[model samples]
Target: MKILLVEDEIEMKDSILQYLEMEKYLVEYASDFNLAMQKIHLYEYDCILIDIMIPHGTGLDLIQEIKKIRPKTGIIIISAKNSLDDKIDGLNLGADDYLPKPFYLPELNARIKALMRRNNYEGTSSIVFNEIEIIPEERKVLIHNTLVNLTTKEYDLLEYFLVNKDRVIQKNALVEHLWGDNADQFDNFDFIYNHVKNLRKKLLELQCNDYIKSIYGIGYSFKTIL
Candidate 1:
């Protein structure tokens, strides 16, 4: 999943970034409030971790803006301030969870996973669609009771497609979702097409139906028959 981390402390930010990356999450960070605002406006994230004491403005204000712009996105407050008032204000401002500083990384990860499950999977532990089953926590995909080996990007692509099944997804949206800020480095979406092709091939090899359909000039759709 994609995450935005808004933190000012260099050590804390680096540690969180490293840990989250190790856990296979696409993460982008902003060390100040203004940069955070810029990223929030320009890109989308599955979840955002914000520090209450930030430069130029407060994370509480950021939460309000995020709720107004992307109400469905998950928000978590991570701050050194452990005051009850701060927590209450953040929660009232639509923050989904709060993590006080000096917290364990594993616990933070667990909170993130729980928040994601609640927001995207309706609090379910696994995602099931027909013969395909995905356990997000274990990063495992099983097809017809057999494990399907997939590269990291391939797995992410499949999950994205499954999550938004039956809707047309633009190539640009795929790039942005997968690559985030680095998406600008690519001049074309040929790489995306290749990834999709490979994913289809893998699924077809397992005797799965071709749920993905190209939309001519637009993009692709993952369709399921009613």
Candidate 2:
């Protein structure tokens, strides 16, 4: 999942970013409120960990912006304030959860997972679609109860397709998501096509009808309906 950490403290932001990266999550850091807004406007994140005390603007304003920008985005307020009104206001502003400063990184991870479950997962860790099954917590996938051998990128692509089944995913978005911001620096998107070919071959080998559609000028989409 993609995450944005909006914190003014450089040290804390670096530590949290390192930890989340170690956990295999895509993380972007914004040390101040302006940078935070810029990142938020540019990309969509599964969650935003906003520090209430930020330079230029308060994190509360971010919550309101997220409501308009990415309404499905999960939010967690991490503030040093330990007052009832602070928590209440954040909650009222639509924060899924609030964590105070000086909390353990593991606890923060747990909270992110919990909020993901509440919002995205709908209380489940595994995603079920036709014959494909994905256990997000374990980063595991199965096709008709048979495990498909996949490289890390292949697996990520499949999971992403499953999440947005029947939606046309752009080629550039896949490149950036898998290869980070420097994807355009590469020669081409042939590697993405190769992975898609392999995934399609494997699914067909298993007789799974769900397949990705090439949108000619666009990219690919996971088709569910006939």
Candidate 3:
């Protein structure tokens, strides 16, 4: 899943971003309100983690602004202010959950996972489709109870395809998600083709049906109705 982390604390922001990345989440960080605003306007996030105290504006304002256009956008308010009024205000303003300061990262991660499950996965830890089972927490894929060994990039690409199955995913989005935000430096997408080739081979070797389809001039799709 992709997460937008908005915070001003250097240490906290770095720690959270690194942890999420290690957990195989695509994360974008914004140190101040303006940077945060720019990202909210530019990209879509599965969940947004906002710190109430920021350099230029309170995270409250950000949640309000984002909720206007993105009601389905999952939001969590993290703040040092744990007063009853603050909690009430955040929840009333459409923030999903409020996490007080000095909380553990594991707890925060759990909260995010729960929010994703409620909003997207309908409160499930694993996604099941036909003979394929995806364990998001473990980042593992099981085909009919047998483990399918995949490279890290291959696994992430497969997960991304599974989530957006039957929808066309642009090559640019794949590059951005797999590489860092700046993937334009690449001369071509030969690397992507390599991964796709290898992933297809592994699935075929496991006797799993191939689901990825090319769009000719556009991109690829993980179609189920095929």
Candidate 4:
């Protein structure tokens, strides 16, 4: 899932980013309020982690903006301040959950997963499309009851396709989801072609239907298997 972390503390931001990346989450960060707003306006995220004590503006304001732009996006407030009013106000403003500072990374991850399951995954732990099944919590993929071994990127690609089944996904969107803000560092999307080709080969080898389709001059679409 794509995550936007709005935090100012250097150490705390680094810690959270590292941990989430290791957990195979596509994470991006904004150190201050302006950068956070820029990112919020530019992209959509599955979940957003907002630190209440940010520079330039309050995290609550950012949450409000996010709600206005993407109403269904999951939101979590991570603040050092344990003020009751703050938590209440944030929750009242469409925030899904609140986490106080100095918490474990695993707990934060758990909350993200819980929020995603509730909001994005339709409250289900697994996503199934015909014979293909994905357990996001376990980061496992199964085809016809057989486990499919995949690299982290491959798994993420498949998950993206399954999540947006029957929709055409632009190459730029795929790059941004996988690489976050750093997607511009690459010259071309050739790497994406490689990943898609390999993923297709593996699934076809398993006798799975071809759900990933290229749109000629455009991007690709993930169709439902008949």
For each candidate, give its TM-score against the true structure: 0.97, 0.90, 0.90, 0.94
Task: Please write out the lDDT profile of model 4 over residues 12-116, one tens digit for every residue.
Answer: 999999999898888998998999999988988889999999999999999899999989889999999999999999999999999998899999999999998
Residue clash pairs of candidate 3: 117-123
Ranking according to TM-score, highest score first: 1, 4, 2, 3
The 0-to-1 C-alpha lDDT of every candidate, in the order given, reads 0.93, 0.84, 0.85, 0.91
lDDT of 4: 0.91
Tell me the lDDT of model 3 at 92: 87
What is the alpha-carbon lDDT for the whole of candidate 1? 0.93
The C-alpha stretches of model 2 lying farther than 4 A from their native spots are 183-190
Query: Highest lDDT, which number?
Result: 1
lDDT of 1 by residue, 52-113 (tens): 99999999999999999999889999999999999999999999999999899999999999
Q: Compute the lDDT of residue 140 as modeled in candidate 2.
A: 78
* Superior by lDDT: candidate 2 or candidate 3: 3
Which 10 residues in a row give candidate 2 its minimum summed lDDT?
175-184
Report the C-alpha lDDT of model 2 over 162-190, residue by residue, as the tens digit. 77778888888787777654575988776
Name the regions of candidate 3 deviating beyond 4 angstroms: 187-190
The TM-score of predicted model 2 comes to 0.90
How far is 190's C-alpha from truth in model 3 (Å)? 4.7
